[model samples]
Target: MPSATHPSPPDKSRAGPEHDLTAAFPTMDLETPSAIPTSGQCLDHLKLLEAFHVLREDVATTDGLYGIHDRFVDDVYPSKGLDEKEAQLLFRLREKRWAIFVANAERRYTIWFQNLPSDRGRMPGQLALAEMSGYFEKTSGIAFDSGINPPLDILMVWHAHLLNPHDFLEDCIRYDKKLL
Candidate 1:
């Protein structure tokens, strides 16, 4: 695996203009609930804690969001001719084998980082998109068509702190719920 400062190897199958990834973005349905958090409805720390306390008392399963993803993913939303920065992110995903949020027109998948060590104490680990061959697709909650490969549009890059005002979260990256 490459270091965070480096990019991954050259591979057309990973991501590029040849991929034609325009049809991979899936929209979220507001009526149903999912384990993943969506967009447009995030709260600050105080509101999060208050909501958590309230939900703790009730049996209502409040599947909310910690934070939203940044705009980098949006820049490459079409996933055509992925630039250096975009390719670098994909290389990180490939190297780390992080369970990223891959989307097609129909569904989303959570590709997990199977090689990560479990003994990180209280610190959270990163999920990266490195190589396409290493994707753990079965755990991602979607069944893809034979020739279909989605774009790695959103990644919920987790952090280990909860000190944000807009998001009562350790951290969030590429966490747009609308793109789920």
Candidate 2:
């Protein structure tokens, strides 16, 4: 057999495994995004799991909800603080005193305004579960719809549990008499 000298086997002893892309760069660590999840993403998943666990515990303990005295904050309702312009607008409307008209109408037509968040709050499905139809009727004499238009100074109302006795007493005293 005749021996011929070639390129000396291309120095494959230094080359690493077929899957070793990291071999090119010693400092790099190769791993898929799915293998090691992000902290923020993991936290979100954990929160969801915690919420589910709490719901299950509540259901097991409460036995299908007897009157549902929500201790935790709902953060689903709508509320707003009136601004100067808003106050002026409402004031002007009241000053008209249309009820005093001696022509035909005896009662003043009442128009109730409600500020609801169309997005970033409670979903429409959850609202249905809470039986919000009565709330809608009492507030605006209509039905509650999630797709309602934008509101002025719309904010979400969170119904937190009354953990403190002082807060409970303060709220009771503050709202004791609607009219003084």
Candidate 3:
């Protein structure tokens, strides 16, 4: 992992000409809520935390090139092909989202992240997209296609269905009505 102090940014020269991602996500708050917040949402935050920890560990024990992977993963979001600065920017954005989730517990919220399905045609290559959709489908009281891959594929939504806000609400309503 590379030292955070001298972390390399992705090369601007290698960036794809078709898109200007820096402009696309000018700020983190521009992101929309694709699904409601739940424990899986919190776990995603934990994953980012773990990723960050791994980067720190690499920086401390190795030459810091390993640490650069964290930045690389960040920059490669959505479409890929980003410079180092862009990658760091992406990491910071995700970190901000994680922070918000940690700091605010009372507020009802939603989950939105990078690399989601913008075009229906792009779905096949994206397994995470399918997973998130399943989670939302099952919990949101909406029917997701049964054929779609389940949320288990992405390492989110593991057995904590009760942590899902929709499922939580459904259980509450059912209990209130003496249906459970």
What lDDT does the true structure give each of the candidates?
0.33, 0.31, 0.39
What lDDT does model 3 reach? 0.39
**For residues 116-144, what per-residue lDDT tens digits would candidate 2 score against the true structure?**
22234333223342244454456534444
Model 1 agreement with the true structure over 9-43: per-residue lDDT tens digits: 43324345543233222432446676765552232
Off by over 4 Å in 1: 2-8, 13-22, 34-180
For all predicted structures, in order, the TM-scores are 0.17, 0.20, 0.19
Candidate 3 lDDT by residue in tens digits, 28-145: 3424565666554565555544444443332332322323334444445545455565546645644554444333311211131222333333332334555756766665444444
Winning candidate number (TM-score): 2
- Stretches of candidate 3 off by over 4 Å are 1-90, 94-149, 153-161, 164-180
Clash pairs, model 2 backbone? 71-161, 73-159, 73-160, 74-159, 75-158
Cα RMSD of predicted structure 2:
30.0
Q: Give the clash total for candidate 3.
A: 11
